[model samples]
Target: MASEGLHAPRERLTEKTLNLHHAIVSLTEELDAVDWYRQRADDCDDAQLKAILLHNMREEMEHAVMVLEWLRRNDTDFAGMLKEYLYTEGDIAHHED
Candidate 1:
């Protein structure tokens, strides 16, 4: 059987591909956690609990960014795209022009 999320046989994949898959999965989970935490915090009535949930959400965001940075460092495409799109002024959709 293949590893949990693999679309192809694990034996057919390269070591680098497996590592990238791991990073991608971790990043997805982290972002999902952030969204879930934010939703729960929004519905929470207790101030202290809400604060704690929001704090946890931010931590998840940090984890996601760390994973993204790993991808950026390891993949030239990610590095190029991030450089082109991130932290720029004006209309984002027009950046390609």
Candidate 2:
């Protein structure tokens, strides 16, 4: 079945492409949830509720990173980009040089 995000027909997409699409969508949703939770936590007046929201947000971040790692493992381009930009101490823009 084709997800709503697909521009082309499902039949036209390769198996690897479909899988990648799923991973990308999952990552996006996880990140979106993280953002929503953070925003809610910031706006909430109750300290307990805010703490719960913050914890949930961290869980979503973990999910997002897992999906991102899957993408890095499956796609060489992402692997290269992550390797170059991630965990670096110097100016990120300098990596482009």
Candidate 3:
């Protein structure tokens, strides 16, 4: 598939950068899918179809989280930020300070 959202020329990007781009794009798509599936589930009148849509939404959420973890593993800044903010119980915005 053609690179739809690239800001720079394809040939200019390094392999690592390209891979990061792919992950970022995939994450975006996964999040979009999650939103779409949840909305469909919310709107559906049929019980079985709603269940299926909710299940698909959860799957999409899983995909999004996997991609996010990949980003944290690959990018030091992401790793640092995630460490600072994730899984903590406090005033989140104030926790940064």
Stretches off by above 4 angstroms in model 1 are none
Q: Write the per-residue lDDT of candidate 3 for residues 21-41, one digit (tens) a residue.
A: 999999999999999999999
For all candidates in order, the CA lDDT equals 0.94, 0.94, 0.93
lDDT of 1 by residue, 1-97 (tens): 3346988888899998998899999999999999999999999999999999999999999999999999999989889999999999999998788
Which ranges in model 3 have alpha carbons more than 4 Å from their true place?
Answer: none
Top-TM-score structure, candidate number: 1
Candidate 1 displacement at residue 94 in angstroms = 2.5
Candidate 3 TM-score, C-alpha based: 0.91
Candidate 1 achieves a global lDDT of 0.94
Native-referenced Cα lDDT, model 3: 0.93
